[model samples]
Target: MISTEYVVSEQPFTVRRTVKWGQCDPAGVVYTVVFAEYVISTAELFYGCLFGQGPQQAKDKYQFGTPTRGLTFDFRKSLRPDQQFDTEVRVGRIGTSTYQLLMHARDMEGDTVFTACLTPICIVRGQRESIPIPEYFKEKLKAHQTSDAP
Candidate 1:
């Protein structure tokens, strides 16, 4: 069974989002791919809030880049256009050169619409070589790490 223990974070970063017309299909339901986009954007926002800099600025100033190495999502409910939702992002796991982000999007009723896990590797921007996560960055991520128990 997939572990649900990782879903509970000590400190989660949340972003409020509204589904737009362009993100929906003819059926008025959000396109599946758009969920992935939401996760990516929320990850950027998480980093921005943690470091006080945007993705590009982080790369330019730190010479390090975080590129998604893997992503997986579970859809529970269809989302409609103009519906408001909240995406909660937490640090799932941190490794030597990679970190996993757990993201869950919930509708107004607090029901989970979808969940995603993103594995991003820290790389040297120019060389594209995996590198150890910076101490400062790792510490910041630790603050968001999920708890062991549900």
Candidate 2:
């Protein structure tokens, strides 16, 4: 029911990280959970590029950061320490108070090490209030929308 193909036409966003010893297991392969962290990291970078240095700026205006409410990852391959991986993030679905990010990790050879979709919701933690996405974000997101089919 969901589209699996990556919509490359959307603005390409990327962040790179080298596999650290602490992030790997005895086998040298990166821990499974770290893959998701890469997704979250790059998504943050995406927001920073669009709006400001961090979500706090947006939160000041919109009252919430993008908090991951759902996550799904498909490990196409494994990544080992001494190797570098870059996370590619793409705008998926943008809504009034939520957005979906399509994220992937690729190795030096261009092999897809992992792929995932993360859905983040805007929520004011203490008050437990959810606010609509700000107009500024919507306008910035338009620059990253896909014009071609994935």
Q: Rate the local accuracy (lDDT) of all candidates.
A: 0.83, 0.71
Q: How far in Å is the alpha carbon of 41 misplaced in model 1? A: 0.3
Per-residue C-alpha lDDT of model 2 across residues 26-71, encoded as one tens digit per residue:
9888898887767766676687778666666766666666677889
Best by TM-score: 1
Q: What TM-score fits each model? A: 0.89, 0.82
lDDT for 64 (candidate 2) = 63
Find the number of clashing residue pairs for candidate 1: 0
For lDDT, the strongest prediction is: 1
At residue 84, candidate 2 shows an lDDT of: 73
lDDT per residue (tens digit) for residues 1-150 in model 1: 532112223256788787888999999999888888888888887888788767679777988999999999999999897788888887887899998998888998999999899999999987779999999899999888887512
